[model samples]
Target: MSDQTGSAGVVLKYTVSPDDFTRAGEASSKVKNILKQMGISPDVIRKVSIAMYEGEINMVIHAHGGEITVTITPQEVLMELKDVGPGIEDVEKAMKAGYSTAPEQVRALGFGAGMGLPNMQGCTDEMKVETELGVGTTITMSVHMEDK
Candidate 1:
């Protein structure tokens, strides 16, 4: 971890492993724990945790593997996920609930329900997805924090 100099927040980075369902939530858990230690409100922590977790799952199931950068500031929490894999074919179609490209086996593992992106969107104040077929995908999500 780098020094938190000149920055109003903490930036945490994690490398995600593809197809690692058992460890999917590890990054999110760590972020949530850090937020708790920092005394962030439960609502804000939940929003950040859930959104990042979905992004993590997306990376594992769709992008093989990826990197997540989470920045926590007094004003907002920002999460950026970048991956090198087959990008999303249709962002609109993928955003719909119950739509999934995950294989049957992945579905049996309790993921690929097609709600990852939507849940991410719902949890954050703003969400942006940049992807190119056969290239890669990057998702940025942010949630604002209220004055305590």
Candidate 2:
């Protein structure tokens, strides 16, 4: 497989729209395509794609809107999603499975089953979330190809 070598990494950025559930997965879809074009393995691509997609959906549902930046290198793929939403108050509780602040309408849409964060963790090599009350949240996720 021809993965990015040396300094030949690629960077991509996407803007997420608020309350736009229909377009929630668009950013992740683009990222997945780019990874494929770079010849990254399907497994790695899948992990990164799923994790980032979940993050994107969360941002749209919870945050007003956000920006997602993805960086690809020979060793790893990294994604950072930043949003200016009501920050997660209890990150520890939020990380737990079946924990979510999504409204009933969102639940009716078949989402907000509280698996977004859990799914993200399961799909990535490493994930970190930072937030402050009334400020915003920024999530950094990385998938290391070397681990394969």
Candidate 3:
């Protein structure tokens, strides 16, 4: 793989629209394609892609949309998603594997299985979630790359 043995850092940014199921995965797809082009190992690419997609979907469904920024380097890939919606009330409960607060409409759409944060945590090397009740939430995640 041409994993850019000594390349400089690359940064990618995307805006996720609220409740836009039609376009939900666009940003994550773009990132996955870019990672493939960069020759990132498939394993790392899969982890980053899954984690970021989950975060993106969460923003679309819960956060009234948000912004995602991805920074890639030889050592790791870092993702940050920020949103300005009604913040999560209980982060501890939200981290549970099947706990979800999504409304029935969203569930009818088959979008909210309450697995987003859990899947993200499982896929990333490191993850963080910061939120305030009336303010917003920001999630940051990273995936470490294998030695080239």
lDDT of each: 0.87, 0.88, 0.89
Local lDDT at 95 for model 2: 88
Report RMSD (Å) for each prediction in the order shown.
1.6, 3.6, 3.8
Q: lDDT per residue, candidate 3, 21-68, as tens digits?
A: 889889999999999998999999999989998888888888889888
- Alpha carbon deviation, residue 129, candidate 2 (Å): 0.6
List the candidate numbers ranked by lDDT, top first.
3, 2, 1
Per-residue lDDT for 68 in model 2?
A: 88
Angstrom error of the Cα, residue 110, model 3: value is: 1.7
Q: Could you tell me which residue pairs clash in candidate 3?
A: none
Count of backbone clashes for each model? Answer: 0, 0, 0
Best of the candidates, TM-score? 1
